[model samples]
Target: MGFFDRWRGREQRASIEDPRVPISSPNIITFLGLDAISASGETVTIDSAMGVPAVWAAVNFMSGTLAGLPLHVYRRTDEGRERVKGGLATILHDAVNDETSSFEWRKHCFDQAFTGGRAYSFIERSAGRKVTNLWPLDPTKTVVKRESGRKFYQYKDGSRTHRYDAAEIIDIPFMLKSDMLQHRSPILANKDIIGLAQAVTKYGAKFFQNGGVPPFVIEGPFQSPGAMTRAAEDLSAAVQKAAKDNRLALSLPAGHTLKQIGVDPEKSQLVELQRFIIEQIARIYSLPPTFLQDLTHGTFSNTEQQDLHFVKHTLKRWVEQFEQELNLKLFGRGNTRQYCEANVDGLLRGDFKTRMEGNARAIQTGQLTPNEARAMDNRKAMPNGDDLLIQGATVPLGTQPVMPVPANDNDEPKADAA
Candidate 1:
């Protein structure tokens, strides 16, 4: 069962009644907002002019969407509206609302030029050259002719002369948030898809120091998406209360006593005990998933600029695979995959699996099979023939391998007698 109905009325959330309605199994849409909340390092921002519709969307999300009260909104565009397909993906941007006041923003008003029509024209002649490749910056040179008094000084042959526009100033913005779409990097055409990418890419680009090498930092305007978390907490609380009234504990996992894992403290008897346990675990381990999903590949101009699929699936896979991987470490060695098995043999300490259950006595004692200790491991191993969709085909790997070569193995040893 879902956390809350997140509905305004009967017309809204009937489709999302199952939480997994439009999504695949093991996926809970209500958790998306929460997953986004928990994710770290990589983040995208949304800023727009005349944001009334956008603001309306945000408020709707906060009020009911994530609270398990599935409400209907336009998730997908065009003919898809008649059906309750997917809950329109809602991303919380703390600064999107306040962006208008911060900069010399550009805006498009419903002009008198479109007098008889309700829509703006897409056929208008453009100003700046169109930028096709958005990444690593465009190399096109925009020259400004020199003209005024002391506008820019030119120094040549040890002599300094007052000259105008002597220097060509290049502006490179891969990702950015600007009020004016025209001012945005990539010089937005429609100010919808490309614009959003410009802002996100510009902002995302800044976090990379020394040219996107290592240590990709999260450069934030760390605005909080209070609605997403608040909704989850409220729903959890409500469910908790219901459980308590019925005298039921959230779950009785091993090593936890009934008293320690007492009945929930919220107020919704409608939730299922199994669902509650999973949801709670999800809440607790939220960071290991959404925070890690990378939306670097897909772009605003790519797919209605909808990032929900990319972000949601990426996070879900990361969490599921990561959890299974951690479990594999508990068994350690013995018939594990070449890489996985080596990781557990008291070697490969740097692998993420090492951080999972390395110190557990069960793993150290070798009392369990690599697959048995972590029941989830078997599913996550390198895909065998049966699992591959295309038989006999192998997934490609980078020449730059995922695993590191030991420095000792890489070192050139001194010449010595055999």
Candidate 2:
């Protein structure tokens, strides 16, 4: 029996109705603000932060990469594990594809996980406790609450509240909280990084506005009040016009001086600062620096390693969370052996030549059989290919026989001839 079936039976036995309907209490949605305000006083919400290029790039890269992956269902039995087929696999692999839903399942998961560090979906069940449809929930409005050590989800929509038991709701969280019920948002944790990003943008703008020079002071000899005012205004107008016209020359009157005051962007290391910020953002998302297109320290060999690292470190974390959630909700907790998994090997696989060479080595070394290697290339197996083969010259260790001597007859004949 499924988790929902067990819960439903208990509820019926206790004569307690499921709280699917809204209560008579006032419909006041409690506000649990992130309080993520930058040092520059900019309110950093997911939407606003996404407007920043670095944040947008990182988030989009992660989401798009994860969305393109294929999720598979597998079953483990006494006969050994095999890819699952039929209803469950169909739902995970194809039914959740783009045609059945407004958005692709992967994309839906990406948006929720990236923005709020959590993704929620409802499993609509039929009369027989069979899943009829799956729909995403707005992570912003879905609240997780625990009472008497039992956790439930409450979704506030306009003036109504939709409640769901843990079995009916799919909650994929990025990282767990202390209570293990709510998730922690990445965006909220690193407001300082976002603030620094804002500063970098502001600095770049000012650099251009000042005609590629930092702020400076103009000192001139004493003059009549009217003359000084007129001279100052004239210099200001000329500099402003030059800036607009992209002119490098700024002609000033005699006794008037333009001394550049602030440190140049190069000398002040603004470029390095920007690069560092990119790396920091990448780190927060557990992505390699190259994934963010920051190749300051990237090399040919390191780039390949980092790609593998991305699949292993970054994508694996998210995929594992998804697998466990799919197993618990879709397959039910009763079936401990059957589970869903993301086919991360697609991302981890190497180029054709490299992969073929590695597989050849595996076969030659007796690590893999011929049919096993063929399966990786999507080719049909040949007869007798399942047998493991090793080079004929090689013998089993400690099993070589000693050759007997045949010199007795030769020795007697040679003795007579001498």
Location of the lowest summed lDDT over 10 successive residues in candidate 1: 101-110
Q: Highest TM-score: which candidate?
A: 2
**What is the C-alpha local distance difference test score of candidate 2?**
0.77
Q: List the residue pairs that clash in candidate 2.
A: none
TM-scores across all candidates? 0.13, 0.78
Question: What are the lDDT scores of the predictions, listed in order?
Answer: 0.28, 0.77
User: How would you encode candidate 2's per-residue C-alpha lDDT over 144-224 as one tens digit per residue?
Assistant: 988888899999999999989999898888778788986877876787787778777888997887577677667788478
Residue 291's lDDT in candidate 1: 22
Candidate 1 local lDDT, 1-418, one digit each (tens): 2434433333243345553244433224433422222122222222331132322232222222122212121323353323222211111111102232101110111111011111111111125421111111112212122244432323232343322232221122222234211122211222233233233344334423213222211222323667445644554554456554664444322432212122222322322332332233223223211222323333556443233443354333432332243223222235232111101122123345653574244444554334333432323433232221222234566544467766676678789988
Residues forming the 10-long window of minimal summed lDDT in candidate 2: 23-32
Q: Which stretches of candidate 2 lie over 4 Å from their true place?
A: 1-34, 97-103, 221-240, 362-372, 380-393, 397-418
